[model samples]
Target: MTFTRQGCLLVIAVALASPVLAEGPDPVRGAELFPIRCVECHVITDGAEKKIGPSLKGLIGRTSGTLEGYDYSDAMKTAGIVWSEQTLKTYLVAPRKMVPGTKMNFNGLKRPGEVEDVVAYLLEAGT
Candidate 1:
């Protein structure tokens, strides 16, 4: 079959994307994903007061229920988790399962790449 110019461009685009697809989630994509997925309820600004949720600045090494002023759910306040890359990756995959009764209502990220990307983004942004 002969390819039209548009079709050829589409093929080239897909080809360029293949490596990124294989290499796992990009932080740039993670940054893109954050606003769409988490920004409604969370913010990443440093020293900012809590919005619907606590600011995610310095989130990486933080204790789960210890965001100072933000009121945490009983279950979360008592669970005693320390946020690490691995823990964040797993928690992002299933929030309710990881911390049942947490106040946040997110359904959890469905894809591994999405989780990875978000975790990667948070690592940078949280700092």
Candidate 2:
């Protein structure tokens, strides 16, 4: 089919902007993934409780290592990060790399889209 340059650009822009082409984080998928990937160490329920890791009940907007009652690694405490969607996405990719001395043992989520999904779940459930 013949197409003008402007028409091709418009088509490309529309494709790029389409929701089907740019699906965002899915909380339901995130919820399913959370149990598989993060439930072992973290809890998202209400309380200052300790599991293998700290309670993630109020994760969004919370400063790293500041959750009461959970003892954080010196590195985490000193990193001084405020948890947010963007930061969570970065940190979830490589926990140790993000905070070199963090006590979290899991290597970090490596699967495509898993980090975003899990972060979405945490934001939804932890809040």
Candidate 3:
């Protein structure tokens, strides 16, 4: 029944790391999940790339369709969309309804948490 420096250090480390390691999505985790869940259509990259959907590179803080050489839905371009954390979060929850007429064919993500994680991945990785 005593205190030890090693135990104290271990407890402090755990406490500090717990918040960072919490259930929230890590961008790395998002990257790994992207291909399986998302890469089928979207190409999230910096280069001039086009997929079944649009390239999502530089997505965070970027205006929709600003990327050249990609054909975007009239709704997406004219919607004046901006991909920020808030906007992406809302959009990812429901793609079709968010941008009506958007060419993206995927149904809305079923899990709010998964959407959040994917957004985190896209934002962090797309850069």
Candidate 4:
């Protein structure tokens, strides 16, 4: 086998880029799963304030710990996280591990499909 400088650079670039992969939820699936599991406590409407939990509008690109008027615990504040579809899915799967000592009481979702569905629902809701 022979390698050129350009080939080596391309391989290195691919190796470095492997850590960032794209993953987003299916909106249809999320819509179905959301009302069944999440709507009891949360709302996703724009301009809507805190429900039993804070409104989740515009969560895809929002900063993790900066929502106004909701009382967040120190655990979530200090997690050094940002909320994206990927982060939401990860947190929804295991909140305790993702942000220890936060007060969300629901058992973390165990199914990938359900998590995707919920995320999709959150992404498309109230818009």
What value of lDDT does candidate 2 attain over all alpha carbons? 0.87
What residue runs in model 1 are displaced by over 4 Å at the alpha carbon? 1-21
Put down candidate 3 lDDT per residue, 28-94, tens digits, no spaces.
6677778987899888766887888778878887887677888888888888888888888788778
Q: In terms of lDDT, which candidate is strongest? A: 2
Which of 3 and 4 is ahead in TM-score? 3
> lDDT per residue, candidate 4, 24-127, as tens digits?
45677677777788788878777757767777887767766667877878887778787767888899998888888887777788864677667667666633
lDDT of 1 by residue, 8-106 (tens): 998888768776556786788999999999999899987757778888988988988888888888988998889988999878888999998888898
| Tens-place lDDT digits, model 2, residues 1-127 | 9999999999889777665335767888899988888888988889887798999998999999999998889999999999999999989999999999899998888876688778878888877
As a whole number from 0 to 100, the lDDT of residue 97 in candidate 2 is: 95
Overall local distance difference test of candidate 4: 0.74
Error of 2 at 123 (Å): 1.6
- What are the RMSD figures for all models against the true structure? 6.9, 4.8, 7.6, 8.0
**lDDT of candidate 4 at residue 23, scale 0 to 100:** 40
Task: Enumerate clash totals for all models, in the order shown.
Answer: 0, 0, 0, 2
Judged by TM-score relative to the true structure, which candidate is superior, 2 or 4?
Answer: 2
Model 3: lDDT to the true structure: 0.78
Q: Which stretches of candidate 3 lie over 4 Å from their true place?
A: 1-22
Clashing pairs in 4: 29-117, 30-117
lDDT of 1 at 126: 88
